[model samples]
Target chain A: MTEEPFRWLEAIANRRDYVQQQIGTGSPVFAVSLEAGILLLGVGSGQSKVFEIFDRQAMAALGHPADIERVRQMLIDAAHLEAFTRASADVNVRRLVSFGLSPQLKQSFEQIFQAPFMIDLLLGEVAEHPSKDVLVKVNFDGGFKIQHGGVMVAAPKPEQVTLATDWLKANLDQKLKPESAALVLLLAWNSLTSGTPLPEKSEQPVKLPDALVEQLSDKVVEAAVLERKGSNVARYVPLMPLLTG
Target chain B: MNTGIAGDFLGLLAQNNLRPLAAESSTRAPEQTHATTVFAFRFRDGVLVAGDRRATAGNVIVADDVNKIIEIDRHSLLAIAGVPAMAFEMARVMQVSFAYYRRSQLQPLSQEAKVRALARLLRENLPLTLQGVGVVAPVFATVEAQGDKVVPRIYFYDPLGAQFEAVAFAASGSGSGTVRSVLSFQERFGEVKPSTMTLNQAIRFAHNVLTVASEFDAATGGVDPLRTVWPVIKVLDANGVRDVEAAEHLDARKEGV
Candidate 1:
């Protein structure tokens, strides 16, 4: 086999290895960012959640902890839409119902969040009271939380809408659950076909200092590049429970 | 009973010269930096947690695909938007703390308890906040209790140990100002209820919101909707987390959206 091809395969292995390591460590969080173009990680604990940042040796110029600290903070902190999932092993049927959620919902949430997973809730719900403040109205007693969103979707109409009608009719129902699903599909589809083109920048531009980049593998860099370019990306990833398992 | 935080768990870690990297109350970080954004909003029937995909340092876009949200426990969501390392470290500490408690108590921490746990984490990060590299504030939301159906909920926190619930919407981020403006105005235009509009409509609404946010919020960057690369949306209904398919979003979008 060609050395280049072998190296490419190795790159793929490296990406999987990174993900596997994160999974094995029981972090219980996996994130796929359209902008980041890769699976990002956040570690979950009962008290709080922690994110992971890799410092490249190149960033030695910026000073040790400071440079890495800045990058780590930025890596997990940046995003427009983020999802959080929390769950417990214990099931409290009573607590579940009080929040307007079905026992099933509670169970599902518990099963999901209870284990380990983090998703960006691009969309969800909220309730606020003058005195009570804004609270998550959905009562998830022994379950999970999953949140997500898309980057940019188009409002295709008339010609494009009609043109795409055939595609819709053909691929409509390998799935169901309605409304939300439809929107995701269209927006994703539209973005893939005719999304905004990215502006050209420094290929030799302000490279993120070599040292800082080193903490991450080639895969991380590749993913970041795609995310930066604004490509319409999608994947039906299992929550952390399945990922970790 | 003892969720992660200033309790014995942290105390024990302290004995070993360890500390939380994420909470707002940990010791002061040597330097102050990193920005995290936690996005949450009300959906037709429940609440959502959507975050930006970018993080900044001074003026640079330091990281993309940063996972700001953390699963504090099952059915609950937590996110931080502060000093990167400590915020995340504390988040991990608290996660392990929660698990320890869950194992010890043989039950998960209560939503209220989880809040308390985070408060403790913040309390510890106090020194750091004072120093400059503070984990400072984090946004936490979980399904506390729904009235009849699977209702969504949201919450925000302050350094002073305040957890404020938000109605309509709440946000934190670099381009938050611009994105918030778009969300506020768009929300004002009208609502597409989960019951009224199909799930597809909900996804479209989400996409529409994201598009608007991206236009204004530089942190959120992506291409317009296209084939294949649909945003994978999840719906929290009577049944936990349901993956909102792309076709449905499109169908809803076409249906008068």
Candidate 2:
């Protein structure tokens, strides 16, 4: 009976490996903060990976479609509830992540008797200035990190996440328009999925990777932006036309 | 009780047992804050919605800076003319609910569905309304797209949640009796119908109507040039809702015919 705890730990580790294997080939989601607002981009075959969570917030995920939907619904409910109980302006990513989502995810993950969530989520919140933008990356195991306005990635392959994010950070311009930012994210996605290395140096004028652009024809790009300057209080706007056009 | 889904914010609030105010505290009659004088009319461009800047509590002027006209979404305006607390709560809930539905469902809630949603909220609030502590008669205005043509619609709701489509105009609150009569008179005999007037003339007519109402009903604070407070007017067209500027209010106040 004394070895029960050790055995349980081993089981937990096995579950981690199982989840990682299940999500290894899932599509990647990327986000970058720009002068207009924050843009979240994801490419997938059928289901949508990008969604608006609140007035100034949006989310993108890569994993099992059902699990991603569950998390997305949970986020939407939490945001609305927060906006209801308090005010809409007070509904932000930090509170939603730190107080609401992270704990729920951790509890679900620790409860080994049930299946852990098989998803990696990227949530972005726009602010008046690009430097003050907020981006949160929530992992399958409930681990998360908050970053100030820059670039972030939730790559399907765990090993390439840092490489992809670093490449984006070095290559992404803070002033890129919505369409251009989407193109940059798509190039990074192509690089990560095709196992090709991004250029070592930044290109003066960003260009679509000719070799990798064709693969995107079969995939639908899901994108949304939270515009900073708008008369309406609801700032989250979908950018499907920006790419599809 | 958790559905593990989104799109119904009010339902979620009920599940959480969250109310704008405690329901059990109705043991004694509390002094209710009442907002007065809100109306809407179809104009040449779209719909012109306006609300007075006064709230009263049993013959006592409680506040003069209250904003009773609320923007539920970009395309809809809600003007309330009853208990300020309950009316504002309803507006807040509708705003969030509309947004929640759009974000979760990935499509705008239909115009019919949006109007019905307000009716549902009033129906739910019947308990408080019967207690005489919460009563809200509100006017809703929106621009609905029909095929390629966008048309403006106005709806007014009773405290018991009965919704009626306002063809030319609708008014609510203590001063509405006078405002309604004047509107009917203008629509029937004036040089231009309220629905056919230009934007500038519409603004002038709104100011004139509110001014006439305040002259008879103390609850409606008309054009208080000394306090520099004018009625809040918003225009809802195919594009969206935009506030009439304070300068425009000055122009309307100065050029009233």
Candidate 3:
């Protein structure tokens, strides 16, 4: 956010520091603490945890009295407690959502996914066959549309693919600014044409492109996301880049 | 728009003493309530988002062909799973909120920032959360640049203002738990899927998990994918999120990422 760092090192540093700042001094559990959770910002090794939000005042005074002002400021701003209340009372805290969904979530998936215009969405839902559990037909009709923001690099088809992998492989890797890598990935992921199925289930999806494959997870494929009316045999087809991604 | 603000929003509401519900995780809902099935999965480069078309209030199906996937912007997409009316309103507000963020920041918020903002919004909606009427619990999956890797992350939220990172994948709404178990087994973690797998592979994954869940769990609906029109499936890869049609699965062997 500051000066939009161009070089990889500087950009990455900015990103890392910014994320750390955002992490701040909060509960390690990410729970909903009504009171302050002390942040042990010092780097914590596997043995010691770094950065936590503490709720005690007297203890904080005894532990690090020099940070009392900072702690008070945090208590006031984060805990929304009065200076006097934060300092005077010995506090005990509990998490509102230790084992359940956060109270902050309640909207549908559509609203949650589409918050970036500079982003692209690939629509890929296919159902119109029989349950492969009972049927013998491998009828597959896959359709997935791509919608993207203004084009920085257009790849309507494989010929037009400007994906980070494609771009970087097409002798542009050296020229690409790290800032544009995100855009390239966005473009490739939103490709309108079909290419290959994802690599989670098969070994081939991993070999298609180094840049793309490296980023993907090695999670095993479940038969949960797909549908086969009855045929155990699969009828493969090309739908969109998202499917092949 | 990414209701990253949902948490903060709910927290703000709760601070004001309003009741909010974690609709996505509401096990206490009336047995006869509209049920929506939603899920999110990380792809090679992007994230896939999907939902069913049926809304059942009890045994009666009130709506069919309800597309849960919505396009919020060019880069991001949203798939909703919750009370329909409440889901719609939350989606609407979230969309407006993105515009608000853009206006305030004078630039579109980063994808990561969007997630946090949506979390905050949900947190601020806490007042409404306690009264059994809450909205905004949805699984958000996206491919973000974490160093050189474009790692896809799936974040699941709770009405009480908490978040958990879902590894591999996550399913929400009425039939998540049962489906999650089934998916855990069905998910292909070891294979190179991007080039050799088919859309049906993903659908089969969804169908297999849903079928197993629906067969045993009363909450999860049975899978009719490929029966009627299969449920909409999208993939988020480096290419971005796109829908996968049945025909696309035909002869998809030759294509590569």
Q: Write down the lDDT that model 3 would get.
A: 0.40
Model 2, stretches more than 4 Å misplaced? Answer: A1-3, A200-205, A209-211, B1-6, B25-28, B253-256
Stretches off by above 4 angstroms in model 1 are: A1-245, B1-17, B22-36, B146-151, B186-199, B222-238, B241-257
What TM-score do all the candidates reach, one by one?
0.43, 0.94, 0.42
Where in model 3 is the C-alpha error above 4 Å?
A: A1-245, B1-33, B103-106, B146-149, B187-200, B217-221, B225-228, B249-257
Clashes of each: 146, 0, 190
Would you list the C-alpha lDDT of every candidate in the order shown? 0.41, 0.86, 0.40
TM-score of chain B of 1: 0.72
The digit string of per-residue lDDT tens for model 3 on B78-146 reads: 666665555555554455345334422225567877677557656766655665555446776666666
- DockQ of candidate 3 (2 decimals): 0.01
Q: What tens-digit string does per-residue lDDT give for candidate 3 at A42-86?
A: 111122111112212111110122232232222222322221123
In model 1, the fraction of reference contacts reproduced equals 0.00
The deviation in Å at residue A207 for candidate 1 is 69
Model 2 / residue B54 / CA error / Å: 1.3
- The window of 10 residues in a row where model 3 chain A has the poorest summed lDDT is A132-141
Of the candidates shown, which would achieve the greatest lDDT relative to the real structure? 2
Candidate 3 chain B: worst-modelled 10 consecutive residues by lDDT: B1-10
Best by TM-score: 2
